[model samples]
Target chain A: MKVDPRGQRFAAAITTVVLAAVLVSASPWLLALQAVVFAVGAGAGVRHSPYGLLYARFVRPRLAPPGELEDAAPPRFAQAVGLAFSLVGLAGYLFVGAWLGIAATAAALLAAFLNAAFGFCLGCEVYLGVRRLLPAGRAA
Target chain B: MAPEQVAGGAAAAAVLVLGTVLALVLRRRSGRFRAARSRGVVSAADEAAEGLRLTAEDIGAPLGERATLLQFSTAFCQPCRATRRVLAEAGALVPGVAHVEIDAESHLGLVRRLGILRTPTVLVLDARGAISTRASGQPRKADVIAALGRAVQ
Candidate 1:
């Protein structure tokens, strides 16, 4: 299945806010909340992703149909990447130190910001790089 | 705000500013393709096609009869879908022009060799498998047509 590209951007916009809040609050709890958000989006398909639902219910109805929809795998992979960063960052803040938490959120913030503002996919590019390095079809 | 709070605020602002700048640069670069060396000669298509070398293995699929609009895609790049549609439609309009979409990761070897830095990168190939032109980002219909003009000349 495919997704409206705008939905991904809408979700990214929300992520940018949550990640930015993590930096200001410096609270493990807040970061954990953001991490859980990532987990849900990554675990469920984009159709069930909270931000996706938000886009479907509130945003899509207000706009014209998308020019075309994109494949689901890449965005799903992107969500997995986000989940990894948020979870690791949450771990850093909780067990390691404040600086790690700040750093992690900063990284995630950069990615979310790029997607929302510029439509660049830093994590998606990283996903490709990783796939290139690994032997073909190793896990799946 | 406290000293720590001031520092955090500064970082937050920095993220936003950097993001804005990055967006500007990407916007400038997206969907622009380099012009081919079309000499306006009737046989120029054959000349361009001479140096081309691609097969089903290179693009993860077979080439079209007269030309191929080979597209490189990734699991996460959204623009690839838009580019695919344009290429597909263009291919249908022009006889013998075929569109092939390749997963960047699956064909990483060819992707790296071709210097494909982003998804939706397209390589317009002539019938003989010569690379006629390339666009690094999601391409517009006009540009695709122009590249096809060069490829199918």
Candidate 2:
């Protein structure tokens, strides 16, 4: 299914806030909460995620319809990327050194901020770059 | 309250500030067409050595009499959708101009050979198939028209 790019950016804005809080507060529980959000986003479809539902219910109703719809695959893949980083961060917070958690969460925060402020989807770009490099990806 | 907490807070603030600066720089530069020779992502020698001309048979599409807007896109790129609209409109508005969209994922060989680093990378080819200019990211309509002007001239 296709998604409204505006909605995706809205979700990213919220994500930027949550990730920033995690980094500044050094809150393991908060990061764990965000990891769950990423899990739902990746395990299920993006439309089924909490932020997606929030955008659909409260935010999207007030805005004009998006000019163009984008394929859900890229954003979905982006969710998976976020989930992976959160997991690494969670591991760092729970078991490893605090520095590891800070670094990982900081990286995720950078990506989220870019999407929120500039509409640049780093995860989506990584998805395309990786696909372009894969040998098996040559076939249509 | 602790000394470590103060240090951590300072570090986090710095990271966010740095990200903002980087995003601003990318925003300023993204989607602006540049001369193919000025591309820094791939060495100019690579493209120069391979020859800058593309054939109709090579891209699996026919060339235009005056100019061709060749777009390399991927399934997951949102900007590619917007870009398709701009290029298609330009192609329709201009005489002897054609817009051809290539799936970058499916054309890995061509993508690598041409040093295409991202989706929505547009290559403006002149009548003889020499790449005149290219841009990575979604370009404005005026810019697309301007690039076409350079190509068809």
Candidate 3:
């Protein structure tokens, strides 16, 4: 199903907050929580994520319906990118040190902030760039 | 705050600032096209109008008589849907202008060849098959009309 672009931005806002918390606290559990959010967004789908639910239930109801709906692949791909980063961050927090986690979460925070504030998708760009390079995935 | 915390905070601040600058630049320049040499299709008389020159075969679609609004979109791009509406309406309002939507995912080679970084990119091509200008993000109706005007004039 097509998704309301605003919903993705809303989800990104929530993620920005969570990622900020992870960076500030250096908490492994918090990074894990973010990882879970990413998993839900990527694996299950954006519509099924908690933030999606929140947007649908609260924010979307209050706002007028979106004029157009966009495909779900890019945002979902973006969610997968977030999942990868958060997992790396969780690993950093658990085994190595808080610094790596902070760094990783900081990266995620940058991307989320871009999406929420500016409406650009850095992760989506990265995915497209990577897709271009991969021989088999070049057509994707 | 701890020294490391201070450093971390500073880094975060820097990222925020950078992202903001990037956003503003992108938003400002989204619908503005630049001078590009098109090897696609253009009559000998219009070589000076080196905008969007594409052969019908190159774009995988027929060119409109007066103008064509070529849009590159991906399934998950939100702005692309909005862009479609603007282009569609603009095309309908103007005589001899057509709107064509191409899925970025399906046309991976085309996207790469064109250096398309984002979705909902609109390419305004004149009747001669030369692209007059192109917009990177959702283009305004006025911009599209203006692009069309530039093309035919």
Candidate 4:
């Protein structure tokens, strides 16, 4: 599916805020809430995610249409990466220790902040990096 | 209010600053063409050893008479699409420049051999198929024209 890159950035900005909040408060419930957001984004699609819906309804109307649309797979893969980090963070907070949770949340926040502020999608980079490493001749 | 809350606030501020600084550095570097090692210095034997020369067969397209804007792109990269438009326009604007885009996903071996780390990686090749300059990430049209000047010169 094609998506507006701006909307993805919008979602990332929201994710940056949410992950930062998870860090400052060290709240497992809030972190869990973000985990669900990631799950929906990954499992369903970015278009169906709450932040995406918010952008579609509220934010997109105020701005010009995107100059171009991009494939949604990379950002969706990024959402899965976020979900992985959030799950690890939840595990850390609920079972392991506060240090692990904080570290994981901080990592996720760094990634989201990069996408939000700079249009540098760290998760997308990782996705491409991993694809580069796979055995050649396979369809990506 | 509390000591812990104060520390949390400070940490949050620190994270924001760090992200901003890192983004600034990356933004400054991204999409700027960097001249590769001077192809003039490399002896014929060394050039053969390095395999820096790409042929029309390797890229699945004919080279331009003056310069070729050879781009490596992946399936899901957003900038690659934009880069295609920019390079195509640039190619068309100049008389002897041609743009060729390769699917980096399908050409993993070639991508690894060239040490391409990201999508929208562009190599400007002169008539001899030697790489003159390259940029990783989306490049501006002006920079591309400038790079072609160096390539064709």
Best by lDDT: 4
Instruction: Give chain A TM for each model in order.
Output: 0.91, 0.91, 0.93, 0.92
* Winner of 2 and 3 under DockQ: 2
Worst 10 residues of 2 chain A by lDDT: A131-140
Chain B TM-score of every predicted model: 0.80, 0.85, 0.83, 0.87
Model 4 ranges with Cα > 4 A deviation: A135-140, B1-11
lDDT, model 4, position A4: 94
Across B32-84, the per-residue lDDT of candidate 3 in tens digits comes to 76545544655656663332357677678899998889998766565776788
Q: Can you list each candidate's DockQ?
A: 0.42, 0.56, 0.47, 0.49
Best candidate according to DockQ: 2
Taking candidate 4, what TM-score does its chain B reach relative to the real chain B? 0.87
lDDT of 1 by residue, B54-131 (tens): 766666677888889888887677677777888888888889878888877666667656666777778888887777
Candidate 2 docks with a DockQ of 0.56
Question: Scored by Cα lDDT, where does model 1 land?
Answer: 0.77
TM-score of chain B of 2: 0.85
Our tally of clashes for model 4 stands at 0
- Deviating ranges (above 4 Å) for candidate 1: A53-70, A136-140, B1-4, B35-52, B60-62
- What digit string (tens of lDDT, one per residue) describes model 4 on residues B1-153? 544334444666777899899888877877899987754677756764675877797788999998999999876676787899999988888889989999888877778877888888999999978888899989999999889888888
What does the lDDT come to for candidate 4? 0.85
Give the better candidate number (1 or 2) by DockQ. 2
Per-residue CA lDDT of candidate 1, range A32-101, in tens?
8777777777788776888889999999999999996777777777777888887877887778866666
- Predicted structure 4, TM vs. truth: 0.90
Tens-digit lDDT track for model 2 on B78-104? 788889998999889899998999988
**C-alpha lDDT (0 to 100) for residue A12 of candidate 3:** 94
Off by over 4 Å in 3: A4-6, A56-70, A96-99, A136-140, B1-6, B37-52
